[model samples]
Target: MSLSYAYLLTQMVIFIPAIESWLRADPHEVLIVTTIEWYERIKASLETVDDPRVIVHAIEVKSKRPGLIAGIQRTTTDHVVLLDDDSIWSLATLQGLLCGLSAGPRVAGVSNIKVNIRMTLPALAPDAPSMFEAMGAGRHDRRAATNTAMAYFCDSQITCYTSETTAYRTEALQRPGFVEHVVEDYWKGKCKLSSGDDGAITRLYQNGRKTGIVVHDECAIEPKSKENTDYLKQILQWSRSEVRQLVRDPYLLLPSHRRH
Candidate 1:
């Protein structure tokens, strides 16, 4: 049987101009999960979409993890799309991501081939480093190294880390073990962590018994401000997350393609 699915947007409220066009292409249900503070406002935005299937859920947790955790918890569809707020998907992009998930029942999720908006141009303007975004982030979005890594994992039958926009089988996430981390993660079985949710989910699918397919060309991301200290802080947070992830699951260092 075909899988039933709904899009679950995280981190930001849905107001992107491009989203209207995207909905025109595939009017699938979209559920935006947010913190309690934005709940009423986000709930009101539901009227913005023509599709009645669209809905919003609110979690008391102030962290972004609540968006993902509460989002998956509220949906009963066979599949859930964990799409970020800053992502831009073309009319065909949503289908493209789903195509990867349709590979087989064993497939847990599908990762999008994400690119940065600066990539819309032939090349990044020479001085992008000083612009609103960091050069490495935009330049690496479609760099050869990233593509090669994806190819190696896909061809080698290894799971790729889904990011930016990914569609996951509901069962894959409903598993008790995976859900626990999403609810609240702990560092070294001691300190509690309410963040690094994106990293945690990626490591789960990448190292889990289930598998995933990588869509080589579809998703694009909005650039961040270089002037914003928030962006710099985010980078620092990611750095710490990497350390915790490696220790939590050493398999991340050399994940095996073979699954039991």
Candidate 2:
């Protein structure tokens, strides 16, 4: 029952809180993998943690996928928990993930539902309506409906596992070509993909003989939201990934072999 927590860190401010929360979950070890530049800048802050279980690994490679793969390779635990730098999790969430994996040997991975914080603007005056309210009279209703529809679709059809807050049996992760399979874009004939590692990993495990689970608990992870230009860029990147997945692996769209 050894557990290793691995985080691919980009922003130190957000990652610090995420790491602190994960530490409270009491994993056997914590691996923080980041770029060498970031590691040098945040070395002092990391040194203050003073935990023998925490190990910082800096790589010359500057991509998230490589850093994550490197960190996973260094894990010495039977179970590995993959986390994004901006994701915040609770101890209960950690336990729930482990419990889900413990349900059966064929369970390759388990991930919790994710909740994104809605971005809103402050009210201009005491009598002013809130930003969401100002969107229109029925905007809230439409938003609620959309949320429900997406949630239903995710739970019922898709492989609801994302790297933001996922736990995997190390055996599944150690499968031959797992890392390269996730990071490479075969459809577009690319050496490396800029994003969509989560989707790739989910599809990989789902296509295997084993199954994956999405824990229905309060183990919701909150990832930092992008704003303005960054938000648009993020949306574009996700859209590209989705298109690529659909084109390359249409079976993911089928409603089969998913565990809730």
Candidate 3:
């Protein structure tokens, strides 16, 4: 049961913590993909680890999808786990995801549950809990409810699986259709997408040819928004991706295609 972990990097501070967690998980190999400019910096930062299993690949392309495709091409393991730099997982979580992939041959991928974390200003109000603390509490409750619905009412209806922390069988990803589904450009190549990788992959598995499962492990991810403008930009990008995907493949929005 060999596993390969692949992720793109932008900032050292965020990537270092994520790398630390991945090292603790002890995968067969770790694949880091980033721009050529940051390659040396990232390599230098990770040099103290002294682990031969870690491999870094620098690409000239600025898009995230191409880096991910390169990493997938380089993976030689039985399973590949695609992750985001902002997400962290436990060793047990990694084990659970691998176990899920072993359940069946048709299982294309397994996605773990995610909890959102946001930074808050606690210094402004010392007497009350920080916004981060309050939001964390609410997020957990919402996560519980979402998990319950997924387990009982919507297990077969789940169509979208997050790429932040997903494990896929190498064979499934090697399928010609799946590869094209992931790396294809939309809107006449005007948009080099940074988002919607998750949605695209989800559509492939939900197309009745394969299966995508949601595991019960906890995978924590930080919010993408640092300020109002950042949040708005993220929303706009996501909306554009969603619209483009719909135009490219309307079957994903159909009732039968989403019936698990």
Top candidate when judged by lDDT against the true structure = 2
> For each candidate, what TM-score against the reference?
0.75, 0.77, 0.76
lDDT of 2 by residue, 1-260 (tens): 33343434345677778778788888888887777776766667777677787777888877777777887788777898887776777558887788777877877877666542332333565645433234332332332343344336644323335656778888788889987786664655744685777777767766434444444536766555432355455555766876776677765545553445
What are the C-alpha RMSDs, in order, of all predicted structures?
4.5, 5.4, 4.5
Pick the TM-score winner: 2
lDDT of 2: 0.64
* Local distance difference test, each candidate: 0.57, 0.64, 0.63
Clashing pairs in 3: 156-260
User: lDDT tens string, model 1, 1-260?
Assistant: 11221223333343544345355546456676666677676666655655666666666766666567667777687877776555566666667656767877767766655555454544456644454354436443543344446446544233234345567788888888877766567877787776566567766766434444444554333423335566567556655775676577665335453344
What does the lDDT read for residue 144 in candidate 3? 42
- Per-residue error for 251 in candidate 1, Å, reads 3.2
Clashes within 3 Å, all models in order: 1, 0, 1
Q: Name model 2 segments beyond 4 Å from true.
A: 1-10, 116-157, 215-217, 226-228, 255-260
Name every residue pair that clashes in candidate 2: none
User: After best superposition, candidate 2 residue 24: deviation in angstroms?
Assistant: 0.5
Q: Which one wins by lDDT: 1 or 3?
A: 3
User: How far is 144's C-alpha from truth in model 3 (Å)?
Assistant: 9.0
